[model samples]
Target: MHAMNRRLSMFRSAVPLALLLVLLTAFHAAAERIQLDIASSGVRKLAVAVPSFANGSGNPNSAAGKDIARLVISGLEFHGFIQIVEGSTNGADYVVQGRYSSMGGQMMVEASLLDTAAGKTLPTRQFRGSAAQQDDLVLRLVDALVEDFTGEPGISRTSIAFVSDSTGSKEVYIADVLGRNVRQITRHNHLCVSPRFSIDGSKLAYSSYHRGNQNLYITDLNQNRTTKAISRREGMNLAPAFSPDGRTMIVTLSRDGSPDLYRMDMQGQILDRLTQGSGINVSPSFSPDGSQVAFVSDRSGKPQVYVMDIGSKRTRLLTLQGKENVEPSWSPKGDKIAYTSLTSGRYHIFTIPVGGGSPTRITSSYGDYESPTWSPDGKQIAFARKRNGQMELCIIHANGKGERTLFRLKGNQSYPRWSPRRN
Candidate 1:
């Protein structure tokens, strides 16, 4: 009996070590498979070639085929991790090709990724949708291709919410990441700003001044476009940020004659007062974890980014290099906070570590960039840039590369906020 007990104990001790070895081996394999190191400071975009897709009906020059290839290449290059080269070049690491066909108003597409050095092709992925959904189908395929190479999926289907004055008044609008399928969410005709989406992307909240006062409102995106006012306090109710769990929100309320940060439920019931009587605290952005929130405050005599512990309510300033910092946006990874900093009379996008460090300026052009919002994957930031007396939406990589205008619209657009990953 004693010998048997000793053997059982030894087995239990060895099992943990064996499991640890297996886990290490799996991690090493995954790291080797993905060649792109997203954290590296240097720009090392993977060289890839996306050839014109072929029509299965024997017409290689079909317009549908060309359209699909164009959309795929553009979507992949927008992420900043992959560079679409012309055809399969000498240094190209991978090649993407596909075939598409239309039948009975439905489109069928099949795409495959080829490993250049390995001289092999991955299994083909097939997609089917209405002919009008060709763009969406290609975007999904590019997302799948990205996931096949990297472990994480691309944000091809994500949308951006912003306040546009195209209709002669500031109203809320939503557009896809590629700037297609633009939809107006609010017809307030007055002024609407700070459009924020719930974590699940099913609801949107914004502050509108249409009813003669700045009031907070929520809209159910999944329902029949019902708009409900959640907070109509006497003073200002603006910049509502949904928590990570989507059950509560942190907003700036000035009902008591001073703009302060308050935690409130979805139904506009105040749960806890986060900040009171301090310098004007507004633009509250919750950390990825529900434990902390990064917001803009003027308590230090200048508007700067500050983070507070949700439980203890202890706050610490984050930006030190900028004179005035506002519109704090917490990254999805919870490592950095992106905000707009005033420099040389111009507002530019900058990011600072959550633990208090020197801010890193992201925009260097002759323009004013503001309202920085991190992508769902933490790889990019969408913001509003005013250049040459024109305001437009722009996106920049988290590492400060690949800065470009996101979309071209008729009128001015501002306060761009990226939605969370779709369900």
Candidate 2:
């Protein structure tokens, strides 16, 4: 683990007693509260079965079948209307089968989706790719099959932006959500992390250590026109939080040797310092209504989540049960905040009601899972999972079921923020 990852590991052991008390109280309150009983009805969940694909000419020990099937099923599972049937038993609403082929210096994959109930073919699609990436071609076809069943475009149309250092420099790269179209976004022979999209989705802001210092820079992604530095403070100008209205941002800076939260305009003008003397404040997340901010700080002890009223400067601790909590991402619906917690020496994503409640664990994998970012529709959470020394981005339904791997790039991928749907 890197130094930052190790710091997270230590936080799980250092939470305070007072916070634990608050968590117990909240749980009791929830148990006592009367809740409405709505009519019981369930959405028809389609079961999808993807059989292992035959590799035409590749390493027999490769992970092609599982990787492609996982990526495709993940996109369907995120929509919350489908369930991926594990194994090869073939008892499912739909079954997909595919094979790889190479011709004319290019690799091609052909796939077909069959309606198991009716025992007939429903849809078929073909994908072409570079001869070297034959497996990726199969995954893309799987995405198309998912779209045909759901009537909604699959995540294959979307791409993930992440940092990778396999080439010896930690630069940002954008790859298809299924791990195709792996294009380098930054060639700045420097370290770049925390890539975020602007409200319009045409610009990106990220922290870079390219100039021998940690600074914030914005790039017009469409035009490839780069802007001036947003912040170049002496220490740790990182974690930019864009406002919902798209006019301002809240960023963390450590210029004074203590990381504190600051609200800044889009043009890099400092608006106000919402926190002061709070121990190592970072990860500022604006509420859905844009009235308050949720952040992580080590003020009362170890890192814990705190919510601050934007106007009154009053603060309240949001997380009380966990020994360490960080990476708070407020839901777009404004009712809850999702974050990562270190419990039992493993990092997992959890969510608490913004009004206060027992934090619900969203992931229970044995690996270190952190950085929970909500989809714009507030129905899914994308996060980074470190399992077996390989780091990959995974998405789970906000309802706490249907976990699937979004993609597995060459290096560690973290800090996923979904873009709002464009008109």
Candidate 3:
């Protein structure tokens, strides 16, 4: 377990348009065909096509190639497995055909694909950057055609990390998954929140109060000022999950007074302690074979949603009907566990079955949704709702069906998290 020099340093949310086109038509209704099993099933769809996109640099009938083929058909119809067919390609099974160029100031784009049943022509991919990273060359040609028809790859290249007070404070930002550039990684002008990310997404830990100590930092998204802190001891160096192989991390320290859940690393040390003071153990996640850990406990009297098992430290009770469950997450194929329950007093989002079952409701509207997360290919989810008082950041489709609005910015945005699809 000897490691260091794992640097990173780049940190970078928004929502709104007809109520965001009725939430981008429920985020393009997710899938219609490609359910490789579960991440909440109900799949199928691949009509494809993309009609406009061919402007070797001029106006040869290319309004920026029909706006880069409507941003590659709205980012491969929001990654549920595509369906955007218009004008022709008869009943598509794929068509894509791209092109773009912009001299010296840089901007490449290529693309190709085709094969409406062996009319063949595969392998193509160009890309190039800097035209303000035109959505990073259409999310790398729509996540390289969804990793050439799903073998994996296409979280539109990935990036999320949230919490924004629109600059009056609550810093810590980062955006991308088609929500565009938007950086600003904690100027710590005060309150910063959760933020996780690291398992090859470079690094980004987070949990700040700026120096008054709510501590726990880590920033490095590749290098431009480096963040550090690691776990400034005191009363609570909160949130941090990481651990799918980027070394170790479970986090949620109360500096021994009680908050619980430890087992850190990647330099922040403290390698053990998995919950002890009896109650309050914050949001920790993991599982996908890190041996287990879902988190958010109230020790069994109230706050629910547990899991734990990291080497037999045993624990259970996973929200049996929620009288208030907290923020669980864990679902990059460890089967399920979404969380954020509550019920009549507001809050929504659910998901059960991580070897258990029951809880389903994935938010049916009415406002208050909480800090959910997931989506390093576990289909989708990125929460934080709130209503008339603002707060944004949304996305769905982990079988809660499509649902949209994931970009637009103003005075409120909360926890988010995402990141890890940058291979």
Candidate 4:
């Protein structure tokens, strides 16, 4: 056991986690305290008026204010829960009014949410940032306004990690939810895939073949992009899903001569062996509370999704309708699991209830969709679509609508993993 732990080392400190938890706790505590009926699930999209922000202060930067407003409108609309009304606030459910000022390379912006019928101004918050990082400031204000209305922060601040072969070799890359700021995370010059973000959004883990082995490695993205091999096992060290608290992860390791799921802590210490040498167990995803795990296995002569009780070590098959299923990603809400199913020789995205139900097809296009990953809010899914011998990362609403291309970069992109909302 000590040798096993030594083989799976890490490159991180404990200080950052403590600080992050404190900030996240405070953010949750200050969420929308006033109940709004329109924010409820299954409710109609709330009509909101988002006129141009006024220029108020030392420097008259009305263009900057308008730019911020435009981006915020696009961000809010992308969430699929807000309907922006252009002209009048008379028929709108709420109004977002704001002002911005810039002086000496710094920007200050404030915005307030107004309940039109109640004639009440909700919370007004001021965000400050350097002129160069104005996008961050604008997104912060956007999330604050979203929480003021929906009791949850908007996903505009989140990022998605994917594998691409742009450099003639598959490498991991990350980009904002808007598909801007595309940054390559790995330069292995060899195949690397299955990029997963820790629950805290501070760390990323993926497997690389640059060192002549498919070894698992983790990178502290919050740190100075330091990468470390947490598992250098002889064989498969594949996809890992972090637990909700970010302290532990369920990773597929084949060190014992057969691929199986193993529970390991952040420090690379094995906590428990979750699966015996089952028939090629892989692609494990943890439930929200960490009480269960959803994974793909071929124990019954075909690849299928199975849920395991973390306590009792008992497992149950979740998908029986598909000939082959792979890449089961549990929803952040803990109610559904999104995965890829091979149907009629074509791969597509599907979701099934956590309590056992028929799978609902989420993609019905001509392309083959694989590796379905959920957005932080569970409202959108990102997957890889293959058509015409080319592959690209694509996204769709949770209900199989609003499908759009997410990336049009140089090469075939696959194995998308959505990150949590940034701090």
Clash number for each model:
0, 0, 23, 1
Indicate which candidate wins on lDDT: 1
lDDT of 1 by residue, 1-423 (tens): 453334224222211000001222323333343444455546366778887789977676787787888899888887777867884556887788689888899988888877777677777878889988888788888887776666577899899998899999989999998889899999989988888888899888888889998888888887727467999998778858889988999888778866788999989999999998886777888889899998877677766678999999998878887666677888999999888776766778888888886778988888878888899989899988988899999998787867889999989998888998764
Q: What lDDT, from 0 to 1, does candidate 3 have?
A: 0.74
- Per-residue lDDT for 1-423 in model 2, tens only? 363456654443322111011222322322122111001114346667866655676432246655555666655555556667887636686677766656678876777776665566654588877978654565466556644653333444455666677687877776655566676777788977777778777778888878898788988877665677899888777847788899999988777767788899998899998888767777788897788999888888778899999889899999998767888889988999999887877778999999998999989767888778787667678888888888788888776766778876676676666665443
- For candidate 3, write residues 234-294 as lDDT tens digits: 8777757878887888887767676788888878899899889786777778888899988
Per-candidate TM equals 0.87, 0.70, 0.39, 0.84
The residue pairs found clashing in candidate 4 are: 8-230
Across 1-423, the per-residue lDDT of candidate 4 in tens digits comes to 442222112101100000001223323322332222223444456788887788765342477777888888977776766779986677787788888877899988889977776677765878998988888888898887877766677888888898888889888899887778898888889978788888888889988888998788898886637467888888777757888888899887778876788999886678999898677777888999999999877788767789999999999999999666778889988899998877877779999999998899989989778888899888789998999999998888888776888758898888888998777
User: Which ten residues in a row are the worst by lDDT in model 1?
Assistant: 14-23
- Judged by whole-model lDDT over C-alpha atoms, candidate 2 comes out at 0.71
Total residue pair clashes for candidate 2: 0
TM-score ranking from best to worst? 1, 4, 2, 3
Return the candidate ranking by lDDT, descending: 1, 4, 3, 2
**What's the distance in Å from true for residue 250, model 3?**
14
Cα deviation of 167, candidate 2, in Å: 1.9
